[model samples]
Target: MTRKPPPDTTPDGHHVVIGGRRWRATDPAIPDDVGARLRVHLMAARRAVGVALRAHDPEAERAARDRVQSAKVALGERGTPWWEQSPEERRTRWQDGLAALDAQGAQGAQDA
Candidate 1:
């Protein structure tokens, strides 16, 4: 027999209980597709940071951390929510973030 996990809801999605402290969960206003894409970037950067640490490469670690920050910002967890912005403004935010990610990839290729 198996038992189901307890509920995690607070007000938004799920309340993350860590060391007896409650924190805001990931931003929910992010569109599904964009959220998934950003998570991919976040995970890749996280892994890269770990690998860089093992390899003792501080420059690569810093770059990977930058990627992690960018992904979080784009996913609406850093600054104001995208939906809260005007239409034109929201579009610009997405474009710039995504373009930066692409540029990071290109830079990685050049470095390799």
Candidate 2:
């Protein structure tokens, strides 16, 4: 009897292919510390989206999506691949993103 081959996936966890179809995966270049912080931001943004929806607040919803986008860009999932960037470039990308998030939080606090 013939046996089926196992699915293929990249060692970096950035992609997997099964049945001749490709699928997306999270970027692997994110350091563990940065990854944990990004995860917290992502989850909070996602919850904000849900909360905003319940409250029928369009502005809050948009802000939450922007937060999610920023976090994704920081993780190199939305913009250029993190693996493709030099160490210095990667550092800049993440630092810029984090600064923006912090500014947003500060502005939000001032607004409230």
Weakest 10 consecutive residues of candidate 1 by summed lDDT: 6-15
Q: Residue 96: error of model 1 in Å?
A: 2.2
Off by over 4 Å in 2: 1-12, 16-27
lDDT of 2 by residue, 13-95 (tens): 66668777765444565578877877778888899999999999999999899999998888776788767789888888877
The C-alpha lDDT values of all candidates are 0.72, 0.79
**The candidate that achieves the highest TM-score relative to the unseen native structure:** 2
Q: Show model 1 residue runs off by greater than 4 Å.
A: 1-9, 12-21, 80-91
Q: Candidate 2 deviates by what RMSD?
A: 6.7
